[model samples]
Target chain A: MLELTKEPFFGFSLCMFSYIIGIKINQKTKSALANPMIIAAIIIIAVLAVFKIPLENFMIGADFVAMFLAPATAALAVSMYRQFDVIKKNWLPIVVGCVVGAVSAVVSIVVLCKFLNMPQDITASLVPKSITTAIASKLSEQLGGIVPITLAAVLVTGIFGAISSPYLIKLFKIDNPIASGLAIGASCHALGTSKAIEIGEIEGTLSGIAVGLCGLVTVFIAIFL
Target chain B: MKLFKKTLILFVVCFISDIIAYFLPFPFPGSVLAMIITFLLLLSGLVKVRQIEPVSDFLVKNMAFVFLPSTVSIVSYLDVFQSILWQFLLICIVTTFITFVCTAYSVKLTVYLINKRKEKTENA
Candidate 1:
């Protein structure tokens, strides 16, 4: 069984199978909390913990899926490129909105970490939490953060964004989809975009567009910090 | 066929961007550099959006899958995370709300001003 897991196909298949199960559960529950990714992660973690599977073996099968992150992120340009017209008309607001979101996330995390006396490495790991995993993971490596913690932070942030965005929008009395979408994408990344998509197409498009922008903005801002 | 080709294009673009970032002074992540380069290419009409739409859509739609391994791998760090879990959770939740509200309000205010400026111009 250990050798089987070490095989390249094993991890990939495990993730795919888990995702399918997650999807089925989500479909049946029809609950936002039943997110497929979270469910899949929960299931995979449970299995790995139960078997005490070597992290190395699991990674052998899993790294291939992780590789998709780079190209997929680069591909974000295509979707946002389609939104070029909307971007053109509201470039000022859009740019400012993304900047605001990125700055707020990074700054708050740093400040909170300091206030709590969190260790430096952990603080660094949390820096890119609000960005998508593709970029956040890379940034964490550069910033010398623990990749796992950074990944956890990014996932938790995404899930929280997806779950809470609607209520936040309502409480803030934000009526415009553009406003809501910009906020969601900036704060939540892809997960947030998924929720935005459920609410409206324009919101979805704007939210998706914000993911790359927030990533880029966070990257540059992180450089300065 | 089309999706495969588009995906190849994105891959090639990313590969080239990585090479470029490797040689640059203070390289931002290659993925981000690739995204910017790709955006520029699309803007100049060098590459049509339709050409990459299929692959882009696939990758973005299934993004959560690619991230699954990393998220699940967190179990390995259980000892480290166990103590700080509540604080991490609190920060994640609070900051998300802060960023969300700040962004929405900023966009709303900015757009409102832009519209107001347009109205003034029209009236004049």
Candidate 2:
């Protein structure tokens, strides 16, 4: 069994299987919280726990899935490129919004941490919560925060942003696709970008740009602050 | 040949940015440097936006899969989190709420400003 687990394909298969099941669960539940990733994680964890399988054994398979992050993040450039015209025309507002959103995200986390008297490490982890996980993880590690905590924070932030954005936009009567997409992407990252795509082509493109810019701006702020 | 050259340039830009980021003493990861470099390249028209589409699209599509490694790491740190689960939960919930509120308010404000400016210009 251990020997079987060591095969690279084993982990890849498990990850893919889990992801597929997660998607199915999401479709069945029709709830954002039932996200395929989250559902898959729970299923994988439960199975591992029940079978008394060590995490190390399971990770041998899961790492295969993680390797795709680089390519996926690179793919966002397509959306950015597609929206170049809109980006060029409203460069000033978008830049200002991203900067403000990124700074506010960090500042609010710090303020809350101070008020709650949370541990410094936790505070550090929370600082990069609004950025994408790839960037946030590195920032967390450098700041001496827990990477897992930051990952979890990023996941939750994205989910929240994705789910609530539509309602928020409706309530605020925000008609501009650029504004809508920027708000969601800056607050939630890729997850929000997914929902932004569903909202409309323009919103989707703008959201993609926001994700990249938010990640960039948050990185600088995370380092300095 | 031109397409290949442009692709090569894109890869070189990304690679060089990564290298520069590695040498930086900043606390954040090096990918941010790559992004900044990419943005600069785009801004300067040294690399047209169209050229980087293939690479960026690849990155965006598989974005969620990247978190699996870290999620797996959760198993190793189960003990640490178990002890501080409540704290972690609180931080996650509150920070998320704060982010949403701040982002929404900022968007609203910006929209208001744009509208005001438009009105003033029209009246003038």
Candidate 3:
């Protein structure tokens, strides 16, 4: 087993396999609720368990893909730059909407935790739930929150925002792309931004900008509250 | 010459901001600093938007793949997570629903308020 693990290519193959299988399952499901990542995670876990492959060993390969997070997040600036005109015109409303969205998310989570009498660590993990997983996980750890729980929260938030945002926009008659994007990005972070991109270029750009802005805002808010 | 100068400035801004953030004793990570620095440079007209485009685009396009490492880490800590699995699931579902409802409502309210204000101004 150790020798098999030492095979340098094994980890890479498994990561690729997980992503491919996950994408395939996602395409076949066509259900908003059925996230490819969640499905892929389950599949990967099952395979690992059956093969008795240690999670640590699998991580050796997976980490390579994860290292791209910094660059990927930085890339959001492109979309943000493209939408600078829209941002310049409606800066006030955009900023206000994001603040409202961020505050609402954080407050709702804290209130829910209090109502449920959840443990402190869990509550802390959830405080940064509106951010992307990479940032949220670090925030959770720093705040002494449960990192796993935070990751799950970020995933669910992103997927939920992605699926429901369109319906909500239509229902509310949100004509402005900037507003729509801000709402999605503020609440769901990166996952929501991906969905925003699918909606249109304007929506994508605004959401990308909002994700970064909201992350920064949430970090400041987290410190005070 | 112009493009090289712009890229150099952007890199310097990013690096300096990150370094400053590291020593700030702040709770937030250094990336936030880099973002602020970049935003300020753009807003101040010190750094050309076109110059930062390449680096920024690279970051956003592959954002999903970035979370792979941590998700894998989650797999290793399954036993720890198992104990709180139900709690975690509940939190995700509930919080997500709450965020959606709040965000939708807020957007609706903002639109309504803005429209009303416009109407009042027009009438007056």
- In model 1, the runs with Cα more than 4 Å from the true position are B1-4
Query: What is the lDDT for A44 in model 1?
Result: 88
lDDT of each: 0.88, 0.73, 0.70
Lowest lDDT 10-residue stretch of candidate 3 chain A: A69-78
Q: Highest lDDT, which number?
A: 1
Q: Tell me the TM-score of model 3.
A: 0.78
Please, what are the lDDT tens digits per residue for candidate 1 over residues B23-121? 977847898888898899999999888888878888877877888888887877889999798888988888888899999999999989998999999
Best TM-score goes to which candidate?
Answer: 1
lDDT of 3 at A150: 77
Compose the digit string of candidate 1's lDDT tens values, residues A1-225. Answer: 577789988888889999999999999998877988889998988888899788788889899989888888787787778789988987898899999999999998999999988998998899999998889988988887888899888878888899888899899999988999999999999889989999898789889878888989999987776
Candidate 1 chain B: worst 10 consecutive residues by lDDT? B24-33
When summed lDDT is taken over every stretch of 10 residues in candidate 1 chain A, the lowest stretch is A73-82
Candidate 2 lDDT at B15 equals 68
Best by DockQ: 1
- List, residue by residue over A1-225, the lDDT tens digit for candidate 2: 656666777667777788788878888998867877777777777777787777777777677666444334434444555567888887866887788778878887888789878788888888888887777887888888898888887887787678788988887777777778787888888888889999998688777777777887887776667
DockQ order of candidates, best first? 1, 2, 3
- Docking quality (DockQ) of candidate 3: 0.36
